[model samples]
Target: MSAVTFVSNPIHEGWTLTHTGGDAPSVVERATVPAQVPGSVPLDLDRAGLLADGPREDGTAADWMAWCEWRYATEFAATPATPGERVDVVFDGLDTVAAVRLNDIEIARTKNMHRSYRFDVRELVQGGANTLTVDFVSALAYARGIDADARHGDVSRAYRGVRKMAWGFGPFGGPPAHTAGIWGGVRIERWRVARLDEVRPLVTLDGDSGRVQVHVRVERASGEPLTVYATVAGAEASAQIPPGEVTGVVTVEAPHVEAWWPHGHGPARLYDLVVDLHSTDERLDTHVRRIGFRSAVLTGAVNVADAGVESPETPQVSPRTEQVSVTVNGRPLDLRVERWMPLDTVLARIAAEDVRARVEEQRDAGVGVLHVDGVGVYESPAFYETCDELGMFVVQDPPFVGDGYRAGAPVQGEAIEETREHVARLAPHPSLLTYGTVEDRAYGSLVSGIIAVLDHDRLTT
Candidate 1:
């Protein structure tokens, strides 16, 4: 039997950008310039010598760019697909809002910059060259159209209605540049037989033993019986999944496992957990996750008066403050946290090495924890991976900041989904200790409920 095949083609070059001045999307015949994928409009415009040099005190350049619409176009040749093969256009991230088209046919519409998107383009892709266009609408215009009641009270109100980061919206930190573009990589994936949809590993330690429970989900073209194999720390486990079932679980236990520790305490030991999908003797897909065995808990004292549980008869009782503490591996850890903000105003300009360097600076300063502030965008995966290796703890806050804003159904739904994706992506990292949102009391119950349910292993404040 032949093994299933999977291939990825990255669309990185041959991109051209066009900028239009109006609020609506239209074609502009002037100043078309070469562009780069995984880049922003400001970066491209500056490269083409179209953008003004230096920051303006009046913020005219930033405001002008934020109000205009930008489009990026690229072309690539599609390869012929074999029988039972599936082709998809995968966007790792899109800044703010965008409409993606393949050969002039709209394939996907995205609004959130923090989430990834994928569109099935098997029918749209031809064997020859095809044109791909991503037309980005003005984020400022979109935010202005939202209802007044759905926004906060400050300048950040313009950014609250949309899922974009609030760092650039002034009054907050960073530049006043409201960025837009394909800030993440775009690629085409072709696969046969089956593909891994999600791979989540929950790591736990009991005394000297460590247990890893891997939950696997797959999408298959046929109703074939598949098996999932998980290997970690010299131990292996396999599960025979029945046909028509999309999910399976495998557990691997390691005896005499070393525990992972935070900085200043002990060595941060890490192990690779590899998972493979198999149909009989042939492998279909594989995934690898780096995990560490440790236990982190957040304990605190709650005040009855502050929690609104005080009665009139208890008027003599004073409102007590909550004293919070963190314990890791059955030892109390002193948290010396520093805010991890954006390294640059433009997201695409922040490289992996830059992230590593920033993290190293914090680690060298005797900082044990890096607090990912709520006002900033989600740090790239490289940030978490670096923290995991360097033995620094991370406490993350969701991107909501300032006075809590009321969100309509669409915005609220997207926020919930984005939270789910973020939790799933960051769960494997040992350095991730807890999640706390800014203005938690003002957010609606639905978002808080979703986070609590999805991240039951970690503390949510």
Candidate 2:
């Protein structure tokens, strides 16, 4: 345990919804409501009987999809803290595009729904009340503009599904609509000196001894003395944490350790791993993770490119698909595959229980591997937690797939940034065994490349 204090407040209230009135609007009539994130305004209004069943026919919410914005405002009170402590406003998900301001000053701009965002707001935190507001824009507008003015032979499909409003979506599961809003809770966390930015633990066992490889990233006071410890099975390893940025691989050797196994293999035993960080003056941060010692090895491969340099009379054969499989603890799994569509078009409204129940439904069907499709935004936390607890393998396909890049297309700098955030956020999960991209060659390369650099433990497909 450590002394770091975090103050969290979910921004579930104090919000206003308005539409840029036009022909074919989802918010047919203007209305205001609390920011019941993870849900859309229409969904909330319908629940409250404020709006009639949304647009009974096609393209009814044209303006709604292409326009419409949600605004949230609240006054924040800074906590009693020491001089060196830092404060941050965190967002787990922002539907498509957002501009956030604190005390009337813009602080962050977010575009990817798959990424978690945070703004170091120490400079903006005031001794008195601080006003923070977030304005969300309809990305569909930008997408529509691009679609109309698209140059010939653009990369693959050029646009992504999540980028614009499409043919299928509404009360019924037709085409998909944007679930605009803060699709996740808005909260605040404050810390001092050192903060445990990230902790990724990989465990393996040999005979009765266990070997732990913990990747720890920390932010501490520059040039200050810091120490870190990894403890398990009554054994521990402590070392000096390098000043400024202390992020490195810390290996711990444990005796009489237990190994975790997947379903039907054996008991899925787990141990509580506690990594504590301390400065010269006081305890700074503690990160606790549920870890199991096991080996996940991906086997089999296929040739991605045809290197057949044949003469006029010669012929060649190319293997363009993957004949891949996985093994755990040296035991090959005859995997039962399970595929899920976008859990919800309105992602934030999805209840934790709902996601868990869905995963359980498949796990009960003996799903050894859950193919997290690369079609939509990343699945929710509940979805991943259930899979982790049940030992279900995740083939994480970052939310991207369409036509591949084309000849003379614009550089996909934004798409690359989105891929960066999605990969970094999902990298710590032990259940994520592979980084699988959709078949679009150009887009897939950009997406897979980020995963290649950021993740070494997981296999790339």
Candidate 3:
């Protein structure tokens, strides 16, 4: 595209955190200490020797921390934006409700910890060192403020209103530990021409041929002619985008494609799928991900199908019956399932090697499927990549458990966007067999509807 230029600077240092009594502005700082992005308030407190060693029987310290607001501040140097250029601060994840400010001016506000956010800062960023701050409100307080009718079978009222992990609120027999902070990486990106917003690759098989469709979306600076290119499994495809159009898809087909299989059944075959955005000869942005070719279906006791039974004396009647079985590549699979739990309550403390090791352990134990519970936060991308490599199937549940959450417009809207983002991230993995249905007292229908609309190819139970 029009002489594209893109540079990303990760802000990984010089972060300091402070706690305040509430969400309101506080001039008095309490216990300022060095902080880490992709970290949580509890983690920083422990590192600073401000928290107790182990879980307290009384939960006095934990309760106090959960009600206090925390703020993370940092400073970074950047050159001012030039003509036709854009600068934005991107957060991969933010724990719960928070407000982002640049140079003392509010730039953006975020509520969902599972969703990524980007705020254009070209106008606010300075040529020299500029202050960037994220102020997080008390997650427990915010959740408790939401007004919703509590129904029967509700697990935790504190977690029902907020889009957070339920396990931290003493659900699933876990200790109560309400976590908050920047739980993912933060970076400043400067670009011109256009940037890739999202890229999704979907694989399907037709007899001996495998088809891959890569859907791409871009944020453009102006109406310009662009092309989307995708290559996978030695096959390439390109699509010309109409001027001003922001979305396009490229399809590639490979004959006699090898299907990916679970461990002990067959070899797991994976291919690199690369998508590039181009304007004329220059490449604007590229997205790369590993994908495998395979089809998984859930049957028996889970998926109810209508069957017609004919009697000698009566006409045919349709009756729904449970078909409880799982199949890969049209063959029945004997599932050895294991529940995958988070290694730590502070998500950022879990490293990539830890995830790989845990999944490897499951694979060694002959676990074919990992039942990722819905009560916890979404695992990092490394978790799924490990499953894809080890040939382990994953049955992911939405972030809704046995709770009666408010189905207000705001709650429904957040849940919809969260499900969409998660499905897009997890759909390309051949190991992901099904997106489990949320069978809670509330939000079950909403979650199922979102999954059905976003990923109809995968089975839902």
Q: Please give the distance, in angstroms, between residue 286's alpha carbon in candidate 1 and its true position after superposition.
A: 1.0
Q: What is the alpha-carbon lDDT of model 1 when measured against the actual structure?
A: 0.76
Q: Model 2 — TM-score against the truth? A: 0.81
Q: How many backbone clashes does candidate 2 have?
A: 13
State the lDDT at 260 in candidate 3: 91
Report the poorest 10 consecutive residues by lDDT, candidate 1: 313-322
Number of the top lDDT candidate:
3
lDDT string for model 2 (1-461, tens) is 34544345665555555443333334444555554554454555545454455532321223344356656566666654458777888887766667899889999876556667788888777786778777776555534434432334221232442342222223134544544666677777777776777676666667657787777777653557677788876778877776665786678998877666666677766677788877776667787766667777766432335332221221111123222355777777655556565555555556788888887888788877676665555666577667777777777666554453232222266567666665655554556667665566657666666666767566354
Candidates, ranked, lDDT: 3, 1, 2
Per-residue lDDT of 377-435 in model 3, one digit per residue for the tens? 76679999998999988878777776567777667788888877888888799888777
Distance (Å) between predicted and true CA of 437, model 2? 2.9
Whole-model lDDT per candidate: 0.76, 0.60, 0.77
- lDDT for 376 (candidate 1): 72
Residue 97 of model 2, lDDT score:
67
